[model samples]
Target chain A: MLYLIGMGLHDERDLSLKAVEALRGCERVYLESYTSCFNGDINRLQEMLGKEVVLLDRKDLEENPEENVLAGGEVGLIVMGDPMVATTHSDLVLRAREKGAEVKVIHSSSVYSAIAETGLQIYKFGRTTTIAYPEGDYFPKSPYEALKENHMRGLHTLLLLDVKADEGRYMTVNEGIKYLLMMEESCLQNQFKKDSKCVGVARLGGDTAIRYGTAEEVIKEEFGGPPHILIVPGKMHYMEEEMLKAYEV
Target chain B: MLYLIGMGLHDERDLSLKAVEALRGCERVYLESYTSCFNGDINRLQEMLGKEVVLLDRKDLEENPEENVLAGGEVGLIVMGDPMVATTHSDLVLRAREKGAEVKVIHSSSVYSAIAETGLQIYKFGRTTTIAYPEGDYFPKSPYEALKENHMRGLHTLLLLDVKADEGRYMTVNEGIKYLLMMEESCLQNQFKKDSKCVGVARLGGDTAIRYGTAEEVIKEEFGGPPHILIVPGKMHYMEEEMLKAYEV
Candidate 1:
């Protein structure tokens, strides 16, 4: 059996009871460690789950490590956040299904709708983008273009920061905004809509998660750390304008 | 303090530890009954959280029936699923925030992402649509137009069945599809695309949730009901097509 369980946000406790129930039933458990990391430590989850969780990096997914480990015993494939958040991983579910392996997905919290933390309209978002490897002057030109396009069509954009944990490089909020403004300048020069309206979301789904306004000018202000998404809102409903008033802009 | 806690999919067991912890601390909890109905009974959650829960309807929101109940006490506002999933209730948060209330949203599983249970790519979905009140000669044409536009853009549409607990009208899969097929036939009289491929998702987030294929002719032949959404997938990535093959289309 192949079980895909979500750890949720950054905590071991954020996991659902159903996830706990499934983890308890598994004979062998493997955690997909590459895509995301815990806000706390994996050791806490290890102690709470009362089971040893083998870590699987990207190479394991590509080369099929522990593929045979499940041959004789049941295996649990745990994913941080929500199991289905990544399209690349669902392909793994298909592969397991092809092998006649019994599969189940234990869902958990994800950053997708957590943008609600910003009090932005979830339905207004366009295609989501991640700030990926910076090879040149800017890293997320594509993401910026997509957000700009979403803004053009009166749609919001959710920018997922790139997380390459093993390399110890998680894009911080300040860096992300700096890269974004720089990218925007390079992409359109001055042909842009009102960039003064935006939101900065940090540590979503965590107890002390923060969602406040950065807008255009304030984004240049300082904010620390990884796991932040910048939002360039499209058309704002009046209620949304009031909602932003509550946040520290 | 008022915390809008999400119980997540289906039963009480799906509760996240944060939500459970809050439920434990809540001196009084008033559930928004009109928002959603649990797959199980309220008693299950009552037993799990070990609290007596009071039900609230739409009138409660309109007239502030909850004012006295939560005014000076530690109060928790429980929703059937994720509280923020229904943006309609976001006002309640703003209202409470106005009263000098410290509100914390403890996130939980919501059907928005859980609809990936249909194995459809989340990015492919365009602006989501909700089926509205079936008035004379019009069973909510806006959702139809939204879905059609998404289809035209080669994007999938997530059709959220409208919920009116006051009237006891939860748009079922059978009724939703009946209306959708009617719209598709009108829009694609000559068939603009290669096929009118669509998928029906039933009881998403619940244990017995299903993602049977309806894009095929087989779906037209085998259609079924309640608590569901219809998906019109635009362009299927090769992998997504393969994943759909695993189901009993």
Candidate 2:
């Protein structure tokens, strides 16, 4: 049996009882460490489950799943947020099933749903984009293009800051804002404005801090941590505006 | 203090340990019962928490929140899926803050992220829409329009089937597919074809069932219960296509 469990959004306590129960019964547990940040304590998680949690790198799990992940016994792979959100995990599930291994997915909170804390309606949000730290000349304009498309349709855009957990690198909200400014400069698109209202959410599903303001103001506010996400709003209803008031800088 | 807790995608066990602990400390607990269907046994939930869980209707929770939900006590309002996904819950949080009530939200899995179980990338999905059991002379064109918009952008569309939990009326996959066909007929748009591929997901997070096929074939499939969600693919990456093949009929 191969179990794909979600660590949810915060500490170990964020895991569902169902997940904990599944973890307690697993023979070996491996935590996927590359996709998203795991805010929980590994020691405490292991203590609670009475199992030694091994860290699984992206390459090892993706490249040699049969040997490292599905070696006959009941093995559990823990993933940050909901397990299947990443294509890699879904691919692993497909691989496991093809090898005749029973796969069980234990679901939990993901950033996709936790963004609701920003008071933005999930339905009003368009395609989600990620702003990665541009390496060399590899800066892509897809994120900015996606923002333009969403903004044109009067929709909110969720900008997921890139996370290189393996390299101890995580994009801050301010960095994401800077990337957006650069995108605006390069694309010369009127979609993003320095004065446009934006919502910066940091440490979501934990000790969360939400700030609502223009790019100028929000960039100055201290969010106090990593794993920050930015939202660029297109249009809002009166109720959404009222909710944003609570977070206004 | 007011605690808004998510019951996650499935049953009582789907509640995080944090949620269970919060419920234990609450002086009163109220379950929001209108927006979505609750799949778990209420009695089991109450028993597990050692607290009586009361159901709150839409009118009461929205109109008389002060007296019904925020009456100077540590109250917890349990919601299906994530607490803030619906605009109503976000409005409640705003109202509570205005009344000087401290609010804490415990996040969990929602259809927005749970749809990842369908093997589609969350980022590849566009704005989500709902297909309601149309009332006489009150049918809306927004859902079909949203589908067209998403399809044109080469983004997948998550069509949330409406649920009138109070009336015990949950839109099945077949009903949602039929609604799409109706929209195509009415608009004479090439966006939704009768032979277009569709994915229907039922009972997400517990006893889950997923089927992928053409509209005609998927509509003929027995999804086995309420709380079913449909996905209309706009464009597929090779990896996504491989994953969908696992669910193909």
Candidate 3:
């Protein structure tokens, strides 16, 4: 059976026993790295799983490189977070199904529910987006749009940053904050009032990570930790408001 | 230290090694029962973690039961899914801080990203709402409202079913579908377009779970699984459309 397992958020231990079982049984196991970042390096996971896992990167899956991985033997695609979280892996599942392979999913913890651990209200969040590394001509608009949309609706937007599998680079909270400010500045320049507030969360789902206040003035007091996300708080419920003050660091 | 650990999607093995470590050293570990319904009982978890864990129902935190577990040593709050996914453990965190106890969070996987693993676009998801078990006085409109809201905004809505902690009752996909249909019927009665499509997932992150197809169809299908969720699709991206057809059961 072809098993698609999720290696939860963070390290090797985030993988469930069922996921571990998938690793042990699969004759060929592949890890996909495009959707989300695995905080612990791949080598460590390889060592922990005691198998040299073949990587099914963005290119490999799109290109269908080595079709034998899914075609031959009991192959498993191991995705960081959850395999189906991104639309790209869904393409792979489609391709695998076309090849007449028996495909199954062994789910793992995803960042979606993990955010609540940061003391944020799950109900308050609106649309979620990722802030990509600024390219020369192409600015990251999704994060800005998502934040704007959330603010307009009085909801919180969780901004996920870019993860480079090839370069091993994770976007920092400071950088994400800077991007938001840049977006706000542009909006102000366009005669729009930029009264939206934000909260920066660093190293989510990890011990010793920081979950502190909102906005540029407040976030200045926070850390420049990598593996971070910025939250734009919208309309807050009484309990949610109480939580913000109560959990304020 | 007050350690909040996520029990992941399943049983003890779903927990990260860090969570196990925290559970081992804690003076008292309270597994919050209000939010989670485990596939495996607490006894198995207690034996696996090698500690006597106490199930802290809602009354312990909400109503004053006059029993304190946080006073002795390091107190462990174990949660199913991720630590803060369902309930705001932050209130407890604030309370602990008021008592001058140091609080630490050990993260686990949540169901949020698992929907993406099912080939749905994560960005398109709007505010999430949970469907409650049918009550005589309650013709609940929350889950339907969330779904309609997402549809209006051209986004998807994740539907989480209610879990009764004390009774060990979990609302299944079948029941959840019925709830949605009830809402859809109301929408139809109100002259609203009730043609909104939904995707029901059974046993998210488990070994044997169904991940795709409409809730109505899924309700008819045999799903002898553990945990389940439904993703009511909104406006689909090109890739998302491809994935739906590709991964649809």
Chain A TM-score values for every predicted structure, listed in order: 0.89, 0.97, 0.86
Model 1's DockQ? 0.62
Clashes of each: 1, 0, 10
Whole-model Cα lDDT per candidate? 0.70, 0.90, 0.70
Pairs that collide, model 1: B198-B215
Candidate 1: regions farther than 4 A off: A68-72, A136-140, A189-195, A207-216, B184-195, B209-225
Better of 2 and 3 by TM-score: 2
Q: What is the TM-score (0 to 1) of candidate 1? A: 0.91
lDDT of 2 by residue, A138-184 (tens): 99889999999998899999999998988999899898898889989
TM-score of each: 0.91, 0.98, 0.87
Best prediction by lDDT: 2
Better of 1 and 3 by DockQ: 1
Off by over 4 Å in 3: A41-44, A54-57, A189-196, A218-225, A246-249, B64-68, B184-195, B207-219, B246-249
Clash count for candidate 1 is 1
- Best model number under TM-score: 2
Determine which window of 10 residues in candidate 2 chain B has minimal summed lDDT: B65-74
Error of 1 at A42 (Å): 2.2
lDDT string for model 3 (A69-142, tens) is 56667887887776677766677677777777777777766667777755668877888888888889888666
Preferred candidate (lDDT higher): 2 or 3: 2
Per-residue lDDT for B45-162 in model 1, tens only? 7888788888887777556745633474688887766677676567877777777778888777776677666677786777777877668876656777776556666777777877
